[model samples]
Target: MSETNPSDAPSPSDPSSPDAAFAQAAELQRTGAYPEAADAFRRLARETLTLNVATNLGACLIETAEFDEAEHWLLTAARHRPTEPVLRRLLGNLYVEMGQMERAEVEYRTGLAFRPQDAGCELALAGLLLSLGRYAEGWPLQEARAGLNPGVVPPVEVSFPEWQGEPLDGRSILVWYEQGLGDQIQMCRFAQELKARGAAHVALGCRPVLADLLATAPGVDEIVPAPRGETVRIRDYDVWSRYFSLPARLGTTLQTLPTAPYLSARPDRRARWSGASGVGIAWRASPTGFNARNKNVPDDLARRLLDLGATSLHPEDTGVADFADTAAIIERLDLVISIDTSVAHLAGAMGKPCWTLLPRLHCDWRWLRERTDSPWYPSMRLYRQTEVGDWTRVIDEVARDLQARSAA
Candidate 1:
């Protein structure tokens, strides 16, 4: 969860005022001192159980993983202002963190009922539904993601009409990249589907780092590099769509997902990394996000994979320039063991054997819930955390499975 800004806190004319206390607590919360913030909020709650205090306390409790207490305070605030959509979203987020997905869905829907245009609530519901494999309902609601503050969908300006399941026979369609590399890698498979449906050309607008790699994706006729600080204009396509929107437009369900190797390492690049063997491991996701801490395996815990003869696949360690190099390395490896990150997606896209480690909190919707296998990647296995902030059990299981596979 992103930190809540303290600027919204009530200002006090006097230092000793309750308003001043609230400001202090809010600042602590904003600065990520959750335990201290929770303590301050608890004291304020004892003095007066206002909605502000209850809500702030609830958020802090959630950061500290005090789910039961968080639920109590959040529900208390909700009871005070039952019509507040924000409170319902908070409750929904809390339920998701606690693995109470059904309750999360209820809270999200209640928020939407109160404010039908609540983008955050809609996005939350979309994620929950998709995680539960209710794709038909989830995909439509996911469009609200663009309406969010600090929007989840990338901003783009183009003259071409947005594709909405229109006929593409002998016409061009541009699949513009959105979100992260992993997202593009996973969704690029749709290019083949578009081709099969008779699109004359499938063009990808993607980051330059991905240009060489995604050029090899099936049905791709053009690579429009989306470099930073430069406007990308591809007026050639008849229609354009965000990469993620393809599933919704195509009416994709779990069973109908295009699960095939739509990407390949260049023959020369694969030959360059032919010496690579054993397990290729990535224990960390991007280190600069709110969810990074939860997604990353502790260095000490990850070193256990090294003991099992796994080699690190991190770009920093491997001195690789781009994903093409990583794909080449993965092509030569027997298996890939990674956290939920781009490497896992790249490996899965290439139909390589991959085992993805999933965190209990804020796990991506693509992995779905309580499943050891992925429909999106037929050759991939999933290892999920059973408890929040715990990796030992998941890693233990992976180790056992790796040993068993080797024995076989």
Candidate 2:
């Protein structure tokens, strides 16, 4: 104000100026208000053109499921700043959202070449490789997930040394569940193996919801609820390991993957749900934006299953109190029909006859591609969509099979 300098003028692109709208857009994106953020970013892109602004707009578009526009913006931005790692990562993320794995791989690799230590990009690449069944490369790169930034993951305080495939014959180990319910169910299979390998005792630090169910699991000597701003008895174990890390530690290949029925339901609960000859059905998963797209079966199909004599045994309908309750019903059911959700995992883990309905695009890595049966769960059958968002074919096939099995 002293001299009214040109540099001090209200330039549109200046951080303090009215046209500097990228900050607001970015903040909205961070808060998960994607549609609003996308609008704000679009305004910013029209007013000013910068690498950061364009990349953010592209990312917001991806979140809003406007993949074609996102590709346009990200590709244009990448051309302007070819070596910018963030832009490359953003583009990679867009490809992944669109289910374009090969293109996504290229963009992620290119970004990592410029910023080798970028944890998010590395993890994306790891997931992509794993989904393609390239476990040898994927598992090693997945270690980068532990190094992800604080914003993406909350910091975990580690009191003891991490167990890295070391001898556990004379020592106790704590296996902590780091991810979701299905992930914990799948990985808990490793505890029995850890015990067989001579860990003196194995304690599981897991979600409180699964504590009762997991207590009946074969190999866990103790079950502790995951710490949530509460003090944990971490000192009880000599060493700690992550649930998912057990695969690599155990050197699990496709051939060595364990079969199911590793978990059991309470005798009392099993007795309660006993004698149901109809199928148990789960049509929807826990609601989230990403999960909304691929993990839900059509409501009509769900109704059709019930019409075809299957019972509406989804947790929402059955008023499931816990995993134990769900397991009890599953143990009683003749078959389980589900979208890819924790229920499917539970049924499969318990060695129940389970048919999982999978989305054609962006399916989970564990399902792999174009497979009818799961190696991880010997009793599980997969019915995948023949095309994106087409649950009709999957539902028809399931209905035919159900009719055939019932008729038999």
Candidate 3:
């Protein structure tokens, strides 16, 4: 890969170069000022007296989200230190982001051979395996990701026993929320299941915004919203489970993804959203397309979806659009059409009929690898990318389906 240097990329012959630049570059890397570090390294190109500086410079590029340039720099540095374990892991992560799953697996496996104890590489390789639906091989590795990062809640350790069935004689069980609202919604299914199993008191901790939504979850005895800086620490409970981890613990497979809708929205909210035909809509979101090579949709597509003469409510239209009124806009909707975001969860939880838009690679545990409908959300349908960035085909298919469904 060709290194992209500024037009005035520094060379060793320059007499005016400052001596502090080299030292500053080193400091920048240590301080995590990766972009500046990359820039400073490029500026000190003339002072390139060692391979260590080049490796550090390449790492800085990786941190700065310059993958193409990062690859070039690291590939060059790797030639000098082909035996460095970090380079292989870094290349593997880059491949993961680039959607080169097979290549990433090789790189990760290669790095693990040299540095098996590296938790980071272990976590990445496990995640890749799981994303590819290679579960038989991935589950053991996936365990390494537990508590690996900060801000992640630790998994509950059961010393007494994991309740099999009808444990609720009167014992309380804690239900831990994980990740996003969507994750929580999907996981809430376990709360009801826990209740049925005799967990009489099921305490839940989740984001405050979802308090009302969670209130509607059948099994929760208490809903605690976690505030910034304040954590929900439970003193005791007979059992515990992270919502998303429920399936894995319960031995869920692609064939059995808890298809029935376990959550239903408030009767009032449901009534307001009912009509002859309604479709929930969610367009843009961060991590919008982490799968399918990640194409962030433009506003134009939202306008097109709206123009389909179907009832449309923006999942993101909180004050951005002069949405006539939230209740009114949502009330007359018959179905939901959404991206893989919180709105999809909302629609599913509401038990409203919905068609979830999907990216090809998809998010982890969406494990609906090639299916058009998800077994996880009963009324929700899926429209997937035929090819990367090919939303037009997906849209046309959706349009045709809508016409046929409406006609039927």
**Clash statistics: count for each candidate:** 0, 0, 16
Q: Which prediction has the highest TM-score against the true structure?
A: 1
All candidates' TM-scores? 0.91, 0.84, 0.69
**lDDT (Cα, 0-100) at 89 in candidate 1:** 82
Q: How high is the CA lDDT of each candidate model?
A: 0.84, 0.76, 0.62
RMSD of 1: 3.9
Candidate 2 residue lDDT tens string, 1-408: 011101100011225445436667766776667678779878867776666566766776776668899898778777877777667777777787677778989998998998886876787787888777787777777777666643222345677777888888878988876667877888898888999888988988877889888888888899888655555555557888877678777777777787858887888787666666678888887764345556788799788888998887666678778898888888888899988888888998999989999886557778876789888899999998877668888888999999999889
Q: For residues 1-408, what per-residue lDDT tens digits would candidate 1 score against the true structure?
A: 212221212121123344778778877877767789899989988887677778878877877789999999888888777877778888898998888888998999999899997887888899999999999999988888765633336676777789999789999999887778888899999998999888999999888999999999989999899886677766667998888789999999998999978888877687667788889999988864436767999888898888888899999988788889888999888999999999999999999999999988778889898899999999999999988789999889988888898899
Ranking by TM-score: 1, 2, 3
The per-residue C-alpha lDDT of model 1 at residue 185 equals: 92
Residue ranges of candidate 2 with Cα displaced over 4 Å: 1-47, 60-68, 96-100, 147-158, 227-229, 288-290
Candidate 3's residue-wise lDDT over 171-245, tens digit each?
A: 886666666666677778777766665667988877776766677677788887776466555567776656645
Q: Which of 1 and 2 is the better model by lDDT?
A: 1
Model 3 lDDT-worst window of ten: 4-13
Q: Cα-based RMSD of the predictions, in order?
A: 3.9, 5.7, 7.4
